[model samples]
Each structure stands twice: as C-alpha cells, then as structure tokens.
Target: MNFLRRVFEHGRFGFVLLLFVLMVSTLGWKIVDLHVFDHDFLQGQGDARSVRHIPIPAHRGVITDRNGEPLAVSTPVTAIWGNGRELQAVRDQWPVLAEALGQKPGRLSERLEQAANREFIYLARGLTPEHGQQVLDLNIPGVNALEEFRRFYPAGEVAAHVVGFTDIDDKGREGMELAFDQWLAGVPGERQVLKDRRGRVIKDVQVLSNAKPGGELELSIDLRLQYLAHRELRNSLLEFGAKAGSLVMIDVRTGEILAMVNQPVYNPNNRRVLQPGVTRNRAMIDVFEPGSTVKPFTIAAALATGKWRPESVVDTTPGWMRIGRYTIRDVSRGGQLDLTGILMKSSNIGISKIALDIGAEPLYSMMHSAGFGQSTGLGFPGERVGVLPNHRVWKEAEIAALGYGYGLSVTAVQLAHAFATLGNDGKSVPLSLIRRDRAQEGHQVMEAEIAHQVLRMLRAVVEEPGGGGSRAKVPGYHVGGKSGTAKKVSTSGGYTDDAYRSFFAGLAPLNNPRIAAVVVIDEPSKGGYYGGLVAAPVFGRVMAGALRLMNIAPDNLPVETKTAAVVPGKGGRS
Candidate 1:
C-alpha cells in the first residue's frame, strides 16, 4: 500500500511539472514571434492600417505687367473635403454640414452615398479663408480643410483678355495663362504620413519630394496703356452702340505689344459672368477686311517697283472703274489726283489703276513682306493667320479689290504690325508678348526712302484739310494714318450692305515715330459707319493718352505764326 501511494504521488508531481513547462514554452514562443521573428510584418500591417501618402500642391506663378505690376496672382485659400465612409456615420449631422457647405442636405447625403466606397470627395473648392474657418469651427467629423490657392486678377476686366484665367484647380484655361501653362505650373510633392482610424493625420513621417513654386512671368503689356486703351474702346463702344471693338498699340522700335484691349470684356475674377464670344482675345483672333488700311501697302508696292513717285498723278475723274463683271466705285469723285491726293481722297479707282499697273506679284510680295498671311509668333493660343490670296492664281478683279483692302482679311494686330513696319522705316521685327532685354534686329521689307514717302503721304491724310482721316490728328502731336470702311461679308456668301468693319491704323510724331496703333469697330449702329468717323477718334484718344504716359514730347508746337488765346476766367497771360 505504501509503494502504490508513493508512485501515485510521483505521477501527480510529474504531470503538474509538465503542464507548467508547456505553459512557459508557449508563452516564450509567442513573445519571440511578436518581438523578433515577425516584428517587421506586424509593424507593416499596423502602418498599412494607419499610414498614407499625401500630395503637396505647388503654387502657380504670378503674371505681371511690363512695369512689374501684378496682373494675375495666387492668393491663399482653403478647400473642404470629406471622407465619405466616415461621413456616412455622421448622417444625422448632415443638415448642419450641408448648410455650412452651401449645399442642400439631400444633395450632401446623395454625394456621400455615391462616394461611400471612395476615401475622399470635395465638399467645397476655393473657398475664402473666413468661410473655410466657419466650417472648421463646427468641428464636424470626417470633414477637413486643405490649404490651396485661388488666382486673383488685380486689373480685373481692364486686363482680363491679356492675363486670362485659371480653373478651380489652378490650371490655365485662356490667354497668356494658357499659352505658357507648363512654364507657369509647378510640380507637386508628396509625404508619408500617419493617420488615425478616423483619417486625421497624426504625424508626418517623411517627405518624398520638395514642392517647387512656379517661376514669375513678366509680360510686355503696360498697365497704364492697357487701362487707357480699355477705357477708350469701352467708351467708343457705348457711344457708337457697336457690336464690338478691338485696339492694339505696339512699340515701333521693339515690336512689343504695349496695349491690347477688346470690348465686351468679362472680369476674370468672376467666371459666372463669362461668355464664349466675350472671352476671346479679339485683337489677335478676329479677322476682318482691312478696308483702306491696305492702301499704303499698295502705294508701297508701286513705289518699290520704281514706277511711281509721291507726286505721280492719276486720272480718277468719274471716281469709278469697271473690272470684268464687278464695278469698283469711290464714295465721291476724286478728280485728277497725285499719289498723296489719292490716299487723302481714298479713291478706289485711283488705287485700282496703280495696283493693276504693278501687276499681282509685286503687290502680293509687298503685302507678304509686310507680315500679311502669317502668324505674329506671339505664342498666343488660337491666333489666326489672316488671309492673303496667293498671287499666282489672282484674277484681275481680285487684284483690284486687294488694292483697296477688300479681297484680303487681317486681324487688328496684323494691321498694327504692318503699320509698325512702316513706322520702323520698312524694317519688320518679330513681335513679342514678353519683355525684351534689348531691341531686336529687323528684316528690311522695303527701302527706307519708299517707306518715308508713304509715311509723309499718310501725314497729309491726317494734317491736310479735306483729307479722309483729318479727325485722327492729336492736338499737340503730328499724326499719320489711313481710314478704312469695309462691307462685312455675309454669313451665306457675298458682302452685306449695311454691316461694315471700320478701321484706323496709324503712327504718331511723323518726325520720328515711336508708337503704332490700330482701332477696329465692328458694325457700328448708332453713329456713322465710316472709319474716319468711328475708328479714328478712338485712335486719337488712346494715342494721346499713351504718348503722354510714355513721356513722348509733342512734335507739333503752335506754328510760330499762330497765337494762343487767353482765358478770361483765370489770372493767366495769353
């Protein structure tokens, strides 16, 4: 009995000791697996649950005028976003959330439902800081505010067409903004971050790449000139009740676009007010028959061929001529006239005789060299290359019509470019929208003497009494320009009777020209339709202001024989 009891006791002690050893081994194995062998795996699983890679947005570049005044700038703003899954749990609080986001509760709920499988959705984009803070103050779950930038235009509608605008995401959509998008957009960066179960960022782990801010862009536009042009064009549109108008000013020496403005302008700050037709940069994109503005070029071709002189007289007694089935007539009889008189009278028959005498090749060559039928290389998006028919296939009527600027079409900038070439002494320089460090070399398009002769004739057209463009004269400055009135081509086929495109292209200070400008009024309804009446006044006003702003000295002082009258209201001497 004693032996049996001892064996049973020993067996019991062994069983308990074995159970204790087994428990210790299992515990040690679990500790080793968790702290050593499977440590990285566990950590990876944990990171996968709570870590995220977040994007860092870079700010867009600033666009400035030639004077370094800001045109388009990026201002700090905030955007609201939500985690749809997290937001679903806060469905009861949706009405308050919707009110804060300026949305209806039903719409918010539907959006959250649609995005339930998605991690994020935009609640509001490009909100003001005050508005964004208002949402954050509510401290609603699943909703967060992200810092972003919204583009602002300081010049507003005055510089709208030139500076352009960006979309909600800060991508360029039009104008210079669209032309140089890549140069103006920066690369985004990324960082590894740790977040809680609710998707709130707990810590930033590491940066993947640094965000680079976009470079600054400086344009050749002068804000002062731009404002002046905008104001004058707007006023003229209102006064004339015209369909539209465009004006462009160029630096003759440098080929820099000093000012470009269009009517029916929309403020870039407010996208809600934008329209398709009003948003276009009309001066660069819209083409119209140049009317009499092409007359100088015709005369230039004649002068270039060594067959014509400034004083050469042509018989335009009846003021009309018939070519094939088409009969070209002047507004009135010009009688017998010299080359200068022909331009002053703007006689169609007089120019037709000259153009026919020169044939098609010389005239086409002259226009081609003057930058017709080509792009200005300003890098503008959708810039039209105006139409200039090939000289090889020209008929007699087409060539004659081209003489008076009807057969071909040109944009306002193209007309300005041609006039600027004349002002630059028949040397053509490439146009630039960006500021240049130095003046560019020009290609000789016509002899200096010929250009000067044409310029002098243009001066007589403005300064001489009874001339077509007499109203174009600036009071204290010598001005030279051409007046053009073209019948607008009908949508179905031939030219319309009542609709017209009025134009004035000119240069100032005949002694040494510095500025070349072009004004075009489309379908003037209230006032006279003639270019001399509708377009010249706009040119005069804009030019006068531009000259003063540029500090150009007045070339025409009171003739020594003329006297100044005294005002009786003040203590000034006459």
Candidate 2:
C-alpha cells in the first residue's frame, strides 16, 4: 500500500512539472516570434487592415492672356467620395445623405448596392466647400470630402472657345486646354495614412510621393481686344439677324492672334447647355468660298508674273463672259477697268480676265504661299486646312472660277493670314496662338512692291467714295479691305439662293499696318446680306475701337476743320 501511494504522488508531481514547462515553452516561443523572427510580418499584416495609400491630386495650371489677365483658373472645391463597403453599413443615414447629395434615397441605395464590391466611388463631384463640409459633418461611415478643383472662366463666353473647360476629373475637353493638356496637367502624389474601421483617415503615416503643380500657360490673346471683338461680333449678329459669325484679329507684324470671337458662343462654366455647333471654333474650323476677298490674291499673282501692273486694264464693258457653258457676270459693267478699279468695284469679270491672263500655276502658287490648302501650324484642335485644287488638274473654266473665289474654299483664319501677309509687306509668317518672345522668320511670298501696290488698291476700295468697301472706312485712319458675298453651298450639292456668307478682310493704318482682321457673317436674314453693308461695318467698328485702344497714331488728318475766328459771345462780336 505504501509503494502504490508513493507511485501515484510521484506521477502527479511529474505531470505538474511537465505542464509548467510546456506553459513556459509556449510563452517563450510567442515572445521570440513577436520580437524577432516574424515581427515585421505581423506588424505589416496589422497595418494592412487599418492603413491606406491615398492619392493627393495636383492642381491644374492657370491660363492667362498676354497681358496676364486670367482667362481660365482652377477654383478650390470639395468632392464627396466614399468606401462602398463601409457606406453600405450606414443604411439608416442613407436618406439624409441622399438629400444632401441631391439624390433620392432609393437611388442612393441602388448605387451603394451596385458599388458594394468597389473600394471607392464618387458620391458627388464639384460641390462648394460649404456644402461639402455640411455632408462631412453628418459623419456618415465611409463618407469623406476630398480636395479638388473646378475650372472657372473669368471671361466667360468672351474667352470660352480659347480657354476651354476640363471634365469631371480635371481633364481638358476643348480649346487651348486640350491643346496644351500635358503642359497644364501636373503630377499627382501618394501618401500612406492610417484609417479607422469606419474608413475615416485618422493620421498620415508617411508621404510616398510629392505633388507637382502644373505649369502656367500664357496665350497670345489680348483680353481687352478679345472683349471688344466679342462685343462687336455679338452686336453685329443681333443687328443683322445672322445665323452665325466669327471675327479674327491678328498682329500683322508677328502673326499672333490678338483676338478670336465666334457668335453663338456657349458658356464654358455651363457644360450641360453646350452644343456641338456652338462649341466649334468657327474662325479656324469653318471654311467658305472667299468670293471677292480673294481678288487681291489674284491681282498679286498677276503682278507676280510681271504680266500685270496697277495701271493694267481689263475690258468688262458687257459685264458678263461665257466659259464652257458657264456664264460669269459682274455686279455692273466696269467698262475697261484697271487692276486697281477691278478691286475697287469687285468686278468678277475683270478678275476672271486677269486670272486667265496669269494662267493657273502662278495663281495657285500665290494662294499656296499665302497659306491656303494647308494647316496654319497653330496646333489648334480640329483646325481644317482649306481646300485648294492642284493647278495641273485645273480646267480653263475652273481656273477662272477659282480667281473669283468660287472653285475653292478657305477658312476665316486662312483669309486673315493672307491679308496679314499683305499687311506684312509680302512676308508670310507662321500663325501663333501662344505668345512669342522673338520675331518669327517669314517666307517672302510676294514682292514688297507688288504687295504695297495691292495695299494701295485696297485702300481705294475703302477710302474712295462709293467704292465696294466704302462702309469699312474709318475716320482719321487709312483702312484697306475687301468685301465678299458668297452664295452658301447647299447640303444637296449646289448653291442656295437666299443663303449667303458675307466677309470683310482688312488692315488698319495703311502706311504701317498694325492689325489685320476678318469678319464673317453667315446667312444674314435682316438688314442686309452684302459684305460691304453687313460685315464691313462690324470690321470698321471693331477696328476703330482696337486702334484707339492700342493708341495707334492717326494716319489721316481729321476732316480739315475750319477754325472760324472765335466770335466772342454775340454781345462781344467785333
């Protein structure tokens, strides 16, 4: 009995000792694993559940005019974002959240269910900070206000087509915004942050990447000039009851677009109301037959061949000519007009005779050198190269039609560029929408003497009494320009009777031209559809204001004022 009791006690003690050693071994192993072998791994696993790497959005750049006037800027705003999984748990607050977001509860619920598998989703974008803050104060699970920017156009419709607008994610959609997107879009950053179970950011753990703000874009537009152009174009459209219009003002010396305005403009801030036609930059994109505006180029081509001179005369006594079953007529019988008289009267018969004399090659070369049938290299989006046919394929009738501006097409910018070449003394410079620091090298397209002679003739068109462009004359300034009225081409194929595109292209201060401008009024239904009556007055008004604003010295003396000896008041008359 004693031996059996001793065996039982020893077994009990051994078992107790074994249990203690096993407990000590387990505790020691756990300590070693946590403090040495698997420390980083366990910590990383814990952090994965509570920490997040988030993106820090970089601000887009500001777009300014040449004078440093802000056209487009990024305004600070807040966006409501949410974690779908966490947001789903806050069903009770869904109605209040929906009301804040301007959505119905059912819609919000549906969206959450649809996004249940998504980590992130936008609840609302482009909310004012005050409104976004109110939502954040609700403290609904997973709901947060993220810092963002909304594009704002200070000039509104006056500069909308040039500055453009960004999409919901701050990506450029149109205009200069799209053209220089990469330069205006900055690099985003990353940061590691600690988040709570409810998906709220608790603290920033570390910054992984630094945000680089976008670079500034300075354009060649002059805001004052742009506003003037916009106002005048708008007024002209209203006065003439036109379907659409466009005006482009360029610096003759540099080929920089000082102002570009299009009628039927849309506000960039209101994207919902934007239409495709209203959003198009018509000055650079839309092409039309230039009509009589192209006569100067034809005249230049004739002069370039040394076959025509300012005094050269063409007989238009009958006012019409037949070219292979096609009849070309003049507005009236010009009756043996000179080169200058052809432009002054806009005689179609006279110009066609001149073109036939010069042949197709010379005329085509002049048009091509003036920047037709090619891009202007402005890098604008959707810019069209106006159509000019190959001279080799031209028939005799086609060549004659082209001379009077019917067989080809040219954009408003191309027309302005061609006139600018004339204003620049026969040198054609590349067009620029961005401000250029140095003078650009120019291509000598026509002889300086010939260009000057054409300029003189254009002056007669405006300054001379009862001329085609008489309405374009500006007091105290020698203005030179041409008028054009073209029948609109129909969708079915031929020209429409009542529809017309009126055009006026000109330069100011004829002696030393500073500005070149083109005004085009499409399908005027009220007042008049003629370029001289409709389009010329717009150019004259806009140019007069622009010249005054730029402080250009008057090239012409004021109407000789008769200074009558100041007869003192009637009582003091001597």
Candidate 3:
C-alpha cells in the first residue's frame, strides 16, 4: 500500500513540472517573435505615442519706403494652441490655464467645450513671447505655444492709407498689404520631435523641411511728405468742419506719388476701430466733378485748335449766357476778358462760348490724352477711374458744361496726374507707387509749346492781381493753380443745394515744374466753402514745405536791392 501511494505522488509532481516547462517555452517564443521578427512594427507603435511632427513658422517680409525707411514690419510674436483630445486629460488644470491666459475659468471652459471634438485649436493669439512661454512653463499636457509674426507699422496712422495693415494670422487685409500679400507671406516648415509622458518636447528628432521667408516690398512713399500732407489735411478737416478731404502730390518729373493722404483716417494698429467708412482710401477710390480745375485742359484744347492764344479775347458782355434752357453765369462780371483772364476769373459764360466754338471732340481728345478718363495704373484695389462722357452727339448744354469743368468727374490722384502731365511739358508717363531709380519713359500727349503756354496762363490765376486762386500763392515760390467749387450730387438724383466740393489743382516753380498737387474738401459745413477759401491754402502750405524739403531753389523770391541779406553769397559781388 505505501509503495502504490509513493508512485501516485511521483506522477502528480511529474505532470505539474511538465506544465511549467511548456509555459516557459511558449513565453520565450513570443518574446523572440516581437523583438526580432516584428521589430519595425513594435518600434513604430512606441513612436506613435510620443513622437510628433510639428510646424516651424516662418517670418513675414518687411515693407520699406522709398528712402529705405521701415514703414511696415513684422515683429516676432507668440500664439497659444492646444490638442483638444490631449488637453481633456488635464481638464482639472483649466482654471490655472485660464488665469495664465488672463481669461475667466468659465470662459475657458466654454471655449474648450466648443472645441471638444477638434484635434487642434487656438486658445489665444497675439500674445508676447514672454507671456506665451510662461503659459508653456505650466507643462500642461497637449498645451503648446507657436512662434508667429505681428505686423507693426512704424508710421502708424500717418501711413495707414498707403501701407495698410495685416490680420491676426499675419495675412494682409487691406491697402498695399493686400495688394502685395503673395509677395509678403512666408512659407512654413516641418520638424519631427520626441515628447515625454508630460507631452513636452524632449528632443528634436529631425528637420523635414526648412522655412522660406517672404520678399520685401519698397514703395515710392516719401514718409516726410506723407506726414506733412497728413497733418495739413487733418487740420483742414477740423478747421473747415468738412465731412472729409483728400490731398495728392506727385513728382511731375517722374509721376511718383510723393504724398497722398485723406481725412477720417483710422489707426491700422487698432483693430477695433477698423470700420469700412473710416478705412476707405478716398484719394484713390472717390470721384467728384473736376469743376473749374478742368478749365486748363479746355484752354489747352482751344490752343491746340489754333483758334485761341493766351491773349485771345472772349466776349462776356453781360457775364451771363443762355445755352438751350441752362443759363451759364459767372461769379462776377468778366466782360471782354482774354483767354488767361477767363481762367483767372473762372467765367462759366466765356468758357462756354469757347467750348461751343472749338467743339467737344477736340476737348475730349485733349483731356483723354492728359489721362482724365482712365485708370492711373496704380494697381490699387478698388481704385475708381473717373467718368468722362463719350457720346456720338452732344447737347449744347453738355458741351458748355464740359468746357467749364462739368459733365465729368475725376479722383484727386487723377486730377494731380493731369496737372503733373502739364507740368511734365505735355509728356504723360505711367503713374507709379513703387520707387524708381530714374524717371519712367513717357509719350508726348500735347505740344510742349502748348503745355508751356497753359502752364504760364495757370500762373496768372495765382500770381496776377485779382486772381481767383490768389490764396494758393506760396511765399518765395512761383505758384500756379486754379480753384473750383462744384455742387455735390444728391442721393435722390440731381445736385445738392447746400453741399459742395472745393478743389485746387496746380504746380510750383512754374518755369521748371517739379511737383503738382491737388486738394479736395468735401461738404465743408463751416468756414467758407469756396475752393480759394478752404482748399487752396492746404495746397500752398503743403507745396511750400515740399519744395523747401526738396531743396528746389525758390523761383519767386522777393526782389530787393543789393545788401548783405539780399545777396545769396558770403559777400556781395559786382
């Protein structure tokens, strides 16, 4: 009996031992299968949990003025973002993170709830890098800060209309920023990195791609002139109680815009104040009747026809004339005035007779050649090309209106361009907003002799006694320009009775014109609403400063006897 019991115990032990050996052998086989046969698969699964491919942001390009001064620039900034799925695990840290972001806990909670299903989301943007780093130092899982760029305009509102501003993502939204967006946006790069259990980058594994920065844009804006124009226009709007105003100055020799400014300007840096009405660049996009500013071109047309000269006489017997049903009246009696006198007096009757005699085709051809009815090719978005009538047959009233600067519309820039054409001795060059090392090639639009004559005649409007634009005279400079006031078209159709647009268009140093400018005051409610009263002074002051800044010798310096102060040299010469 004892021997049988011992044999059974021995059999039970052998069975248990066999089972243990089988288990050990199977475990060893499985270990070898994973570590050797499926090595790549195992490693990939491990990497999938902690390795990340992240984006490396590239900086945007810079924008400079013609003189190499920084107008718009991109400054390094930071943005806080997160992976919603991973952030959910650290939900308890919501209040702490909210505090760091300067946001309420409830607000942060609501934002998280809205983005619960999103893999990636932005928590805050446009934060300083130091603030962003503090948030990242919290080491909360799934929370990260990315490097970004914010546009900074050094010139601020002074250059807001021309340089424009960008969006939160550094995307160009308006003005020159939008116009040159593609050339100013940068390309992002990709990098592979390894993260720890807390989701913090532990190592940079590899760089998959390199970032490429955007190109620079240099505009022809002279900042000094821009500031001068801005100050004068802003002050004028306040002084005249005008609804809005625009001033445009061009380098006649090069067709380069030296200065362009508008009233009601908003600071591009302040996003909250970016309303559509205030941001509109009225100088380029708004159009109005040229008024008497167009009289110079009309006289140029008459001169081109060989029928009128600077001394040609026009019969203005009663200072009023009837064409069809419309009676054209002068502001004052302009009886028996010459061609120059008609322009100086801004006579509606005398100009009407001249238009009737020379006909509309010649005037249209002349104005069109001077760039009155076409785009300035400035490539600005929403720029309007002013209206100039094109008709097979014209009514006598239309012809008469066209002669005295009516039945037509022009932008302030376009008006400046036309005057610049006259200043360029009838040569029409393409208008440019970008800087050019030299003057652009141009085509002759009118005879140099004719343009010179018209320029000389325009001088009488400012220099001669009893001239309409006497207020436009710049001290110590030979100033020449015309003043105009036209009734604004009402919203319900015909012209408004009370509202009017005042204008002044002219050039300085009349013999060797360097710059031409146009100023427009819209709906001046206070002070005098006449062009001579409101707009001419702005042109005079701005032009005077521009000429002095440019170091152009004054052509109309006061005459005096030989004296120490009178002589330009150290000692008076014989």
Candidate 4:
C-alpha cells in the first residue's frame, strides 16, 4: 500500500509521458498509411512528374525545274528549346547564362516562367547554326538546340510563278507549292522520350511517329526559254508605253509551247513587292477580241466549204455593208477585190460576205474545231476558255460582225493556234505549254490541200505591196499572217474611244512551215495604233527569232506557187 502511494505521487510525470507517447503513435500511424496503404497512388504521382515529351520534324521535298534547276529547297536551321524543371533548379547561374546569350535578365525571367508552366516552348526559331552553337557553349541548364528546315528559293525572281514560296513552317503557300502541297509535305514522325528524376534524358522506350521525306515534283517549263520571253516582253511593255504585254510561241509540228511570257511579272521569291496583276498569267487567263487576227479562220472557212475561193470575186466596192442598225465597214474603201485582195486589205465587207455564204454553221464549226471556245488543256491552273456565243445565240448582224473579229472574245493562244491549223495543213492539235517530246495526235478539220492553198493567200497578204502586214516580212523565211484592231470593251457600252486590242498571228517559212506565233497589245494608244503598225513589228521580231532558232530554210520559189499555196484545200482557197 505504501509503495502504491509513492508511485501515485509520481503520477504527473507518468501522465505527461503517456500523452507524448500517444501523440508520437498517432503521427507514426499517419506516415505508415501514406507510405504503405496508398503506395500505388503516390507512385503514379511520382511517375507523372518524371515523364517528358519531345517533337520530331519531317523534311519537305525539293522543287526543280525541267532542266533540274532548283526552284525551292529546304535547309537545316537551329531552334532554341529549354527544359523547365532543370532551369528552375539551377536558377543561380541564370544571370550568367543570360549574359552569355546576350539577353536581358527580365527576358530570361519570362522564358523561365513559360518553361515552368508549359512542357515545351521555343525560346527562338529559325536561328543559324552558328548562332545555335554560341548558345550551346553557355551550357545553360534546360536550354538546347533543335534541328529544323528553312525554305529557300535559288532562282529568286527568275521563275517565281512556277516555283512558289513557303511559310515559316515550311508549308507551301503559293504557285506550284500550293498546287502540289500534298507531294511536297511529308508525313511527320514522333517519338516518346524518358527522363530521370533530375529531368536528364535517360532512355527512349517507344517511337509513336514515323518520319517521311516529301516526294519530288518536276515541271515541264524550260528555264532558258522562260527567261528569254520574260526579258523580251518586259522590254516591249516598257518601250511601247503600254500597260502590259504577253507573247506565246508554239511548235507547229509538236504543239509544245516553246515560250510564254507576260509583262508586269512578279518574282515569286519577292512576293511582298508584287501586285495582284503582276501575278496574273495573261497568256492563258486574259481573253480579248483578236481583231483582224480572227479573219483568217473566216477566210479559211469560206475557202474550205467551196462557198468562196481565194480568186473568187466579192462586191466590196462600197467598203461597207449596212445590216439592221449596224453598218460594217472595211478599214479602207477597197474596190471589187478577190478573196486575196480582201484579206490583204483586211476588208470587213469581203469577210462578212464570205461569212454569209458559209453561213453560221461552218464559221462556228471552224472556230470550235480550231480549239477556241474551250480550254487549252495545258495542265496548269488559271486558264480560261474564251467566250464564243453559240450559233443559237447568233443574230444576223451579230454573226456577220463575229466573222470580222467583233462581238466575241478569244485568247491570243487560240488565235495563234487557229493560224497554226493552216500552217499545220488544216489539222487542229491541242496546245501544250509543257515540254512534250512524244507524237501528238491531231484532229483534221480541213484537208491538207485546202490548208496549203490558204497558206499561200496569207503569204500574199504579207507579200503584197502596200499590204497592211508588210511589217511581218521575215528575212530568210517566208512568213504569212493577218493583222487586226478592235476597240476595247467599255463599262458603258459599245467600244471605248481610245482603248484598242492590236493583234497579229503568223506562220513562218510559208512553204513547209515549221513554227507559229501570236502577238497582242492591249489598249495600245501609242503613236501607231493599228495592228499593222503596233502588232506586226512584234510578230516580225518573234517570227524571225523563232525561224533562226528552228533553222527553217527559206523557200526560193516563185510568187506563183507561193500564191497558189493559199488556195483553199477543197475549194479554190488561194
């Protein structure tokens, strides 16, 4: 009993000890629960923190011209990327790292903040390799360089319309780049990367994405001819005080487009300096009244149907024919002229009369067969099928005027191709802007004999004294063609007072012709506005150039055979 009493006296110390023991036991139970009972949950949380993601880039394809000239290419560049966790842990050396990278401390602070919040972020894009190496020498925690592609145009402005340009992401934005974006942009590949506790790269377990290189694209444009045509067209546009100009050269035998050029051109490489009109491809997109250039088709149609012969006389004594409310007048008061003289003078009366004889049926058929009123099938974009009112839309006066190159629209290419029909022995083939080295099948409209005769008459049109197209005469080559001028369309109605479309379509070496060309001047208000004055000289230069290039030998034949060659294949065309 006495010992129990003594132990009771020390009960305060025992009570304090008991309370401390209970507090320690409660804390131990909680630590056990967190470390053992919920071990899987804590492990999952730790694993989420240790995981990291990285990006892999795909390489785009290269673009080359027909002769393997590089239009666009991809080059290697460096990207500055940072690791958020590592940079946060090594915050002490940040000022030194910023000084080495030539950046202010505040800017780096913002970058660090972004890295902490965002798993992946670019500190810099499209930096040069040298710049990247300088950044790497700092050995800044969490910051490194990445590989990327930067687009480049080697030709610069040489072939901008063909090669196209790309955005900063290496995506095709314009021209063939946009047209063939699918082939140029390859499938992107990806991989999953692993990191240790300190965020250092450890091991790569699996690849989630496969890398692919873009496919190649080859163009049919000849770089040399394209450059030549662009140079000449620019000179002409500047010299003539004209708004713009376009020229196209076609191979008579193969239908390959040797050259196509338009002024107000833009270099695809320097797109920022270009206007919308500069990028327009007028050779295919713009359609205008081809003036007297269209007369050959009517003359050919008249001769082919046996309705009118080249020697056949027509009463164009008055030089004007009044029909309904419209009066059709020739360029001059030509006396009674045979088909040959009428064409030489570009008489509206003679062509109108011939159109009446042949009727709307044959005229429409000839134009359609000549590849007018339809697309050229050149395999490029931005081409228009020129507007030609159907025969069903033809009224008496309208149809007659259409015969003289009015009330309808056609592309310069189509007009050149129509004359090519006569030069090609009355066969109409599809016009090709691309380089085609194979045999192309053509559709025959007029027989070879009739086409031969028509060629002769066109030669007479150029060879005759005081002829409108005398400027088209080429040395060492017999050339024949027609000249035409039409008042341009106005916003109000009828024709604009001063605006005109001057045009000429010609074939060289009248005997066994080889090449054909067309020249057009839009709104040419220069000193000489006539097609004979403004457009024929252009034809002469281009025709002579083409003849020399093709090595077409001259025909030393007498004027008789040359004249007879103009005869219509079926009728007395020449």
Best by TM-score: 2
- Pick by TM-score: 1 or 4, better one: 1
Ten residues in a row with the worst lDDT in model 2? 565-574
Ranking by TM-score: 2, 1, 3, 4
Better-scoring candidate (lDDT), 3 or 4: 3
lDDT of 4 by residue, 1-574 (tens): 9999889878978999999999999999888987989788777787678755666777888887556777788888888777776788788877876776667988987878777856556777677888878887776667776778888888666567555578777787666677777888898777777777545567785788777988876665556656665676666666667777777777787776666667666766456666876666677779988767778788778877886777799889777778888888876878888878878888998888888777888888887888878887764556688987785656778778878888678877777777777888898777764456663899997888878887787888888896788998887678888888888888898788888877778888888877788878776656767888877887787777666655667774445555555555667655
The alpha-carbon lDDT assigned to residue 464 of candidate 2 equals: 88
Alpha carbon deviation, residue 517, candidate 2 (Å): 0.2
True lDDT of residue 50, candidate 3: 91
Residue pairs clashing, model 1 = none
Q: What are the Cα lDDT values of the candidates? A: 0.91, 0.91, 0.90, 0.76
Tens-place lDDT digits, model 2, residues 1-574:
9999999999999999999999999999998998898899789888999989888888899999999999989888999988898877878988999999888889889999999988799999999999999999988888987888888999999998878788988999899999999999999999999988778889989999988889999999999999999999999999989999999999999999999999989999887966878889999889999999999999999998988888988899798889998899988677989998999889999999888888999999999999988999998999999899985477879999989998789999999999999999899999999998866998999999999999999999998875788888888999999999999999999999999999999999999999999999999999889999999999999999999998999999766755546565654422
Those runs of model 2 whose alpha carbons end farther than 4 Å from true positions after fitting are: 1-31, 559-574
User: What are the clash counts of all predictions, listed in order?
Assistant: 0, 0, 0, 20
Those runs of model 1 whose alpha carbons end farther than 4 Å from true positions after fitting are 1-34, 559-574
| TM agreement with the true structure for every prediction | 0.91, 0.92, 0.90, 0.75
Residue 90 of model 4 has an lDDT of 81
User: Least lDDT summed over 10 consecutive residues: which range in candidate 3?
Assistant: 563-572
